[model samples]
Target chain A: MSAQDLDGGSDAETDGSGEMPKPHTIRLELVDEPGQLLAALKPISDNGGNLLSIFHERGSLTPRGHIPVEVDLECPPDRFERIVEALREAGVNVIRAGAEHFGEEVMVILVGDIVDSDLSDTLHRIESSADATLQDLSLSAREGTDEASSARLRLAVRSGRVDETLSVVRDLAAEKGLHVVEPLAEGSQ
Target chain B: MSLRLAVLGAGAVGGSVLDLAGDYGHDVVAFADSSSSAVDPAGLDPSAVHDRKERDGVVGEAAPEAVFDADYDVLVEATPTTLGDAEPGFSHVERALADDRHVVLANKGPVAERYADLRALEAESEGTVQFEAAVGGAIPVLSTISDLGAPHVTAARGVLNGTANFILSRMAAEGLDYEHVLAEAQDLGVAEADPTFDVDGIDAALKFVILANVLSDGETEYALDDAEVEGIRNVPGTALDLAAEDGRTVRLIGEATADGVRVAPRLIPQGSALSVTGTQNIVQLETKHAGQLNISGRGAGGPETATAVLSDVSRLE
Candidate 1:
C-alpha cells in the first residue's frame, strides 16, 4: 500500500485567532524497531501539535516489514503543514497528512419493522443523505411478544455536522415509520 | 405569616394539602369537593372534613360555589388537569385573582395551556399566582427557576413524568419488554389504569412547556402544542439492552429551551444525574453562569405533591 490519505478534512479557517486547533489524522510508516514510534511522534510534539491518540498497528507489517502507526493530533491550521514538513525532515516516513476535520462519533437507535422496511436501503439512504459514515450497526428482531424491532446505528459524523446528520436520520426514520432515539449529547453534570 | 386557605378539588393532592395544612401553620378555613363545600369563619377540622368526604361523599352541607365566598387569603386549585381552555382550574384562578386574593395551584392545566392568560390575570390583581407543584412535584423546579431569576436560567430539561420514567427504568433494569413492564407498573400503581396521558409523553411535555414559559420570562409564551413529543411506548427492551451494552441507559427525557420544547426517549449515561430510577423524577436546569443543577426526588405522590402545594401557599403573601 502506498499510504493513501485517510479522508481529507475540511481545513476551515479559524479567523487566525489561533485559539481553536482542528483535529487531524496522520498515518506514518515506521520500521519495526525499538524506539521507532517515539522517534516518529517527537516531530509532532515539537511542532506544537497536541496528540489525541496513537494507534500502533502491532504485529501487522507492510511487505517492507515496516509497521503503520496512526496518530490523531490537533493544531492550528497554519501549523499543520509545518508539522508534516518537520516529520519528513526528521527522516520519518510520512505516509499521509492534512486532514483538518475533527471526527465525532454519534449513535442512534431506530425502532420499528427494520427488516421489512428494507434495512439496507435505510442505511444506504442515511449514508447517502448525510455527511456521515455508518461505522457499525446492530439489529434485534422477532423478540418478545411485540412485532417491533430495533437497530442501533453507529455513525461517524464530522464535527459541526452532527445536528444536520441527526436531522437527516430523523427525517428518514419518519419516512419509514421508524422511531429514532437520539442522545442528549450536551455534557451532563 | 399564616394564611387562611380555601382548598378546592377533592383529589389526592387536595386531600393531602388539607391533611398537612395545619402542620405547616396554615389554617384550612374552607374546603370543597366537586359538589360540596365546608366553610367556617375561624377554621375547619381536617379529619372531620375528610371523614365527611369519605363517608357522606360530601365535605360539608355548603355547595361547591360556597368556597368562593369564604374570607380565605388564598385559593388552592387542585382540580383535574383539563386541556384547551383548562376550564375550572383557569376559572378558579381567575376568580381568586378577581377577589384580589392569592392563588396557588397544583393543577398543571392552567399554567401549561394558558400561561400568558394566567400572567395577565395576575398582573391585573393585587394578589399574585404561584404554582410550584405543577412542574416536578416535590422537586421545586419552578421555585429554583424563580430563585435563580429565570433570566439566569438558560434552559430546563429532565425526567418529569413518573409513570414513563418508571416504565423505562424498569424495562432497562430488568430487560423486560415495554408491555410487560408497563403491566407491572400498572399493577404496582406506578402507572395509571389508562396510562395514555403518562406513557404518551403528554404529561412530561406539559411540564417542559411550563418550564419554557417560565424560563422565557414574558419574552414568549409556550403551550402544550409548541412541544415536540415522543413517548416511551415505542422503546423496546432490546433498545435498552443495546444502550446498556454501551454503558448508557434510555430515559424519557424532555428539554425546554428558547428554541423549543422536546420530549422523547433519549440515551443518557448510566448513573448520571439524570438517570434516576423507579418513580423518581429529576429536573436539570442549565444556567448562564452557574452550571447545570440537578434536582431529583419523588416527582409525584399525595404528600409529595402536597408538600409542593404547601410551599407555594407559604410563599404567597
Candidate 2:
C-alpha cells in the first residue's frame, strides 16, 4: 500500500529542527532461520529509524513456531509508520508498533458542494496535515451536490492540537469553497 | 440504549454472546459463521437469526469482510484460535480497528500472538482492544490484574490450561499413568483429539505471554517459544505419588515476570494455594504493595467464556 493508504499521513511529522525523536517499539515474529533478524532490522534502519535495542527471544516461540523479537527504535512519528509498513511489506510479522497514544478529539462540519469537490482528498489532506484521524463521519447530501451538501466529522487528534486541526480544516474548506462549522462553535461561517 | 455489534463467529462462544447480548442492551447488527456471514444495518432479528443458523446452517448474507463496512460500534472476534500468525481472527481485528471500531476478542490467537500489532492498530484508530476471554476463560484474571493496577503486579503465575491440569490431577489422584489419564480426559471431552497444544504446554504458555505483556505495561512481551515449556506427556504417576507422600502435589504451573516466562510441572504442598484440581483454573498475582492475590474459578466453558466476551463488549463506551 502507498503512504497515503496506510494512515493517510495522519501522524505528526518531525521533519523540523529541534524535534525530539519519538521512541517506538515494534514486536515482530520471525521465522527460525538464519538472517531473519537482520532482514527485519533492515527496514527500520533503511527507513531512518535509529535503533535503540533488540530483544530476540531465541529460546521462545509463538503458537506458530516463529521466534518473537522486539526492536526499540527512535524516529519521527511519520517515519515510524513507514518503517512499520516496510517491515510488513518485507513479510515480517509486526506483532506491535508505536506506544504513543492519540488522545484528543475534535468535531467539525463542512458545508457546500462537498461531494463534487473530491471530499476524500480534502479528508486525506486534513488527516495528513493536522495529525488527526477520522473517528466518525455523517455526510448529508440530501439535496444533492448540485445545490448544497454538508458533512459532520468527528476526529481523534494528537493531544493539545485541536485548534491546529480546526485551522487545517478551515483552510481546506476555504480552498474548496466550503463553509466551516467549528467544534468550539466559534460561529459557522 | 442500544449499541451496535458485529459478531465474527457463530460457534458456542459466539452463540452464547448473541443470546445474551440483548440482556446487556446491545443490538446484533452483523454475524458470521465459519461457512457464511450475514449483516443487517437496521439490526438483525435474534430469533430469526437463531432459527436460520440452527436449521439452515447460515447466519448472514455477505462475506465476513462485509461486516467491516457495515455500521457497528464493536467487533466481537469469536473465531477459532489460530496460533502463530493468528489468521482470520487477526485479519478481522485489523479490519475493525482500521475502520475505527472497538474490538472484543474471544479468539486467543490475535491477543496472545499479535498483541503489540493490535495495540498499534488501536492507537491509530478511534478504538480499543479487550480480550478477557483469551485467558482463564470466565475467570476474569486479566481484568482483575488490570483493575488492581499493573505496577502493583510484580508477577503473575497460574494453572492456566484446564485440560493439562485435569490430566495431571487425575494421574496424581488415581496413581494412573499419563496416557491412561489423557485418554480418559479425551473421552470426557476435556482434551481434544490432538492434544499437543494443550498437553505440550503451548496453550498455557500463550496465556503466560499475554499476562507478561500486560504486567509490564506492554513493554516486555514473550512469545510462546520464549517460555521454557514442559508438558505432562512424560510425567510419571510415581512422581505425583512421591510428592503426595510428602504432603505435596504436582501441578502444571505457568509463571511470568519482566525477566521471563515458563510453564512446567511444579510441586505444591497439598492444601496450599496453587494446588487446584479438576478443570478449574487459578491465577496468583504477586504484588509489591497490595500483597499476593489469588483468583480461581471455572477456566473454560462455552457459556463461561461468553460472559468474558460480553464483559469486554460492555466495557466499550
Candidate 3:
C-alpha cells in the first residue's frame, strides 16, 4: 500500500470536524512463534490505527518466555479502547491498554548481592515475567561489605496483577539467592 | 466473681499473674516453677512467695507436678512456648481439662501447634480453653475474634513481634543498618539475647498460626510449619532508606486468613495504622461487618501479657 493511499484510505478521518487523532502507547507480549508479531499488528491497522513505531524486543523473553512488543499508534480518542479489545479478542496479550491506564504501582526491595546477580538481567526478566515497567530504582551497595548490597525497585504493573508481578519477582530473587522485601500495601495507595 | 487459680512456670508472665491476681478478684491456690511448687488450700501470699523466689530461686516446697493437687478453679499456664509436641505445657493443659477445670494460657505452643487437639480436649471435658496471652500480648486478639464471631472475621494481619518492630522502626528512623540497629535494640532490652526467634519471624509466624487456627474454626488446623515465614535479618539499612524515600517503611508483618499464614518483612506506608513504631505492636482484623479494626499497643512484657491472662480468667466467669 502506498503512503498516500494509506493516509487517505479512510475519508471519515480526512474530515476536520471530528476529534483529532492522538498518540497512544500499548505494550504487548507476543509469543516467539513465527508470524505472531504480524498477527498482533493486524488488529491495530484493521481498526484504523495509524502505526508509528513497532519496538519488538526480540531476544528479551519475559519470565513466561514471551517476547515484549511495544506499539505506538495514533487513533481517535474513542477508538483506543476498541483497538485493545480487538487485540484481546484476536488472542494478543496486551500488557498495557494505554499510557493512561497504567495499573498498580508497587515498590519492592532486593537485599543481598544485587549487582553481582546481574541487575539488568534481573530487571529484564521481572519486567517480562510480570509484564511490569520499572519506573525507578535506588541501589545501595556499601563500599565495603560484599553482603550488604541491595536495590529498591519501583515498578508499574498491569491492573489487578500486583500479586502476579510479585510472584515473578520472587521467582527471580529465589534463583539469585537475593532476598525480596515485597510491598504489603499493593492497592492500598 | 472471684476464682481460685493455679499458676504454672516462674517466668515473667507467671510471676505477674501471681502478683496481680488478687487485684483482679482472683486467688492463687497454687504456684509452681519448673522444679518446685507452692500450694495452699487457701490463697497464697504473692509478696511472700515472690520474696522467697527472689531470695531462694524456688517458689515453694512441693514438687512441680503437685500443682494439680490444689483445689483451683482455673489453671493459668504461663510456661515458655515450645514447638513440636509442645510438651509439658500441653500435658499441663490436658491434665487441667481432664480434671474439669478451665485453662487460661500464655504459652503459644499449645494453641499454635495443637489447636485441633486442644479443641478436641475442650470438647470432651467440662471446661473450655482460652489463650488470649498466647498471641498479641495485652491486645486481646483472640477475645476480639470471639466477640466478632470467628465466622464473621475474614482475616487477621499485624506486626506481632515487638523486637522485630523495634529494630525495623529504629533502622528507618536513624538510617542505620540491620546489624547496627539490632545491636542497639539488644542493648535497649527490646530484643533478647537469643534474638533468633523474634527476629527470624518464628514468633510472629506462631502468632499468625494461632490466629489461623482460631479463625479457621477447626476446619483446618495450622502449626508453625504451615506458615511461610521470612525474617528481618536480611533487611539492609539501604532498603529502609529506599522505603523512606517513597514515604514508606519496612515492617515484619504477619497475616492470617482462611487461606493460610505468612510472616515477612514487608513495605508499608509510614503513617499507616499497621506501621507501629519501636516495641509497639498492632493487630488489624478484617471483619465482615465492621471493616478493619486496628488494635495497637504494647505486645510483650510481663505486665502487658499479664493483662491478657487475667482478662482470660475474667472471661471464664
Candidate 4:
C-alpha cells in the first residue's frame, strides 16, 4: 500500500478481534555513522511497536549528509506516541513523526532568485517553522540564480492550521525577497 | 471455549452478565452480591441463581467469601459504584488479579480511585484488567482508545453522566428547572433517589479519571479527587435559555487531557459534536493521526454494560 494510505486509513483495518492497531510512519534523519539504523529500531521495538517495514534511503542524504529513513510500524496509538518520544529520547533526529495527519495541503509559488537563496535552508526553516512539512516541491531554476525563477512548494499542514501556516509562508517569502502566490487567498490579489 | 467466571455484585450489571455469559461461551462458576453468594466448580446455573435471588432474596447457600476461594479463570466485577477507599469492589478485584485471574470490570470505583493500587495488583499477578464498561457503558470507548493507543488519542472529552445529561437536556429542551427535571428523572428511574453521585459530577469525574489513567498507560495515576468537578445542581434553566438564544446548549462534559481531568457543565455550540442531547453519551477522542473520532451511545444500562464486560472477557484471549 501507499505510505499515505497506511497512515490515515489504519482505523478501518482491524485484526481478527475487530480492533484496529494503528499504523504509524516515523521519519528519521539518521547520521551516516554505523549502527544508526539499529539504534533507531531498538527504541521502537523496546516500546512494544511492531515493525512493518523500514525504507532506508541510503544513497540519498539530507543537506547535513544524514540518511533519511522511514520506518513504518503498527502499534496502538498511545504506544506510537511513546515510540516517537522514545526515539527522540534516544537522540534520533525525528524529521517527521505523524505525517499522515497533516490534512491541509497548501501549495505556494515562490518567485525570486530561488536557487541563490539556499532552497534547502528555506525548506528546512519552513518545516521547522510551524506544524507543517514539505510534501513535494518542483523547483525550476533553468533561467539561472540571477534572474527570478519560481519554485512550486506543496506543504502538508496540520488540519485547521492552514491560515497560520500560510501566514508563516507569507512572512518567510517576504523576508527572502520572494513573491508568494498562496492557494487559499487567491482572491486577495 | 468453556471459560469459567467468578462474578462479583449480582446487581443489574452482574446479573445481566450471568444471563449473557452463556451466549459468549462463558459460564459463571461463582457469583456474589452484598448479602450472599453461590459457588460451584462446575458452572452455576444463571437462571437458578437469579431465581433464588428473586424467590428467596439470597443467592443460594454460599457466602460472599466463597467468591474469593472459587475456582475460575476470569473474574467479572460488576459491583455498585463506590467512592472513598473504593471498598469491597477494590478488595474483590485485588483478590482476583492477585490470584492470576483476568478481570473485566463494570465497577468504576477501583479503576477510577485506586488505579495505582490496581496496577500494582496486576503487576503482581498473571492477569490483566479491562474495564470498557466503566467509562461509556456499551460505547466501547476505552477499548477504542486502547486500540488507538495513547499516542494518537491526545484527549478524551465526553458527556459521561446520564442522569446529569438527562436533567440538563430536559432543562434546556422543556425550560424546566433542575429540581423538576431531576424529579422527572428519578420518577423515570434515570436518576437514583439518592442522586448525589450522578448529579454531583462524581460519577463523571470517576470515568474521566479512569480515562486519564488509561490514556497515560498507568504511568500517571489520577484519582476522582484529582478531577475538577462541577455538578448540574447550580445550573439554572435561565442560563440554558440564555445559551440557546445564542445558538448554544449546555452539556455536562467530562474532559481528560494530559494535564488533568475535569467534569463541569459547559456551553456547547449548537450542532457541535459536544452538543449531544438526551440521556445519550458521547466520547470524542482527539487523535494525532486519525483526526477527531467521536463515539456516542447509551452510556449506562445493565444489559449494555454487560456487553462491554463480555467483550473484555473475550478480549482476554
- Top model number, DockQ: 1
Tens digit of per-residue lDDT, candidate 2, span B51-115: 98888888856776777778899999999988888998998898888888899988888877877
- Per-residue CA lDDT of model 3 for B152-253, tens digit only, reads 999999999999999999888987777888888888988888999999999999999999998998889999999999998899887887788789889999
CAPRI grade, predicted model 3: acceptable
Which CAPRI level is candidate 2? incorrect
TM-score of 2: 0.61
Question: Candidate 3: misplaced stretches above 4 Å?
Answer: A1-101, A145-147, A186-189
iRMS value of model 3? 2.2
RMSD of 4: 20.0
Q: What is the lDDT of residue A94 in candidate 1?
A: 82
**Per-candidate clash tally:** 0, 11, 1, 6
lDDT for predicted candidate 2 compared with the true structure: 0.77
Candidate 4 global CA lDDT score: 0.79
The alpha-carbon RMSD over the true interface for every model, in angstroms, is 1.6, 31.5, 2.2, 23.3
Worst 10 residues of 1 chain B by lDDT: B238-247
Compare candidates 1 and 3 on lDDT and give the better one: 3
Fnat per model, in the order shown: 0.53, 0.00, 0.55, 0.00
Residue pairs with backbone overlap in model 3: A63-A129
Error of 1 at B233 (Å): 1.0
> Residue A83 CA error for candidate 1 (Å)?
9.7
User: lDDT, candidate 1, residue A161?
Assistant: 76
